[model samples]
Target: GCLPISIIGLLVETTHLSLVTPVGWWLLVYSTVVQFCIAYVSWFAALARLPASVAAIGTMAVPVIGVVASAIALGEPLGAGQIAALVFTLAAVVLATR
Candidate 1:
């Protein structure tokens, strides 16, 4: 999929280029590979032990983790409504798992 888009973009002379140092590009690629490898391993491990229904529901935590991680790491704000929603989601997940 990425190869087709890349080929078309190059053929159309509309390919956008970024200015990153060689080291930076290498680091970016390395980190992407490492992160994906870790994610797949974690996913497979979870599926090995968790029931399908529970694993399906477990995916709901991903957004919650993203919200919290962004607030902490990126200094993003969490409003009252967001906090309430997070609480409700966590409560539902916990209740459903039980």
Candidate 2:
């Protein structure tokens, strides 16, 4: 998903590569290893063990959690439309689980 964008970014910003500090490089490596590799492996392992319906519910909740987390952590707004969507998503998950 990120490959094309990453390639384009690298190509365009090649000249500015020297601006990345050691900390930035370390963070990049850490995030790539932990978030991409470890997280995906753990998620797939969980998926393999979980029932399909349960996994589906968990997958559906990801966006809801992201939105709510962004609101709380990043001070992102949760206006009426977002609130309504959240409500509907939760309602659907509840209905599906039953």
Candidate 3:
């Protein structure tokens, strides 16, 4: 799903490759291997083992986690709308599991 967009982004940003420091390159490689490769494989393996409903609820929780993580790690603001959305998402996940 993301391959095409990633390819395009890589092509577009190729000229700026010189801007990346050695540490930045290492971080990118680490993120690619850990986030894209290991995380996806682990997620799929767990999904295969879990019941459908549980897996679905777990999938739904991903965005909620992302929102909270961003708020804490990136100093991103979580206003009323985001809080409400998170509440609604949790409610839906609860309802779905039952």
- The candidate scoring highest on TM-score is 3
Provide the RMSD of all predictions against the true structure, rounded to 1 decimal.
3.5, 2.3, 2.0
Residues 22-52, candidate 1: write the lDDT tens digits. 8987888888898889888988888999887
At residue 83, candidate 1 shows an lDDT of 97
Better of 2 and 3 by TM-score: 3
What TM-score goes with each of the models? 0.68, 0.77, 0.82
lDDT of 2 by residue, 1-95 (tens): 89999899888774666899999999999998878898688778878999878878877798899999999999999999999999999999999
Give the worst 10-residue stretch by lDDT in candidate 1.
12-21
In angstroms, the error of model 2 at 38 is: 2.5
lDDT of each: 0.85, 0.89, 0.89
lDDT of 1: 0.85
Q: Write the per-residue lDDT of candidate 3 for residues 13-53, one digit (tens) a residue.
A: 75677889999999999998877897788778878899777
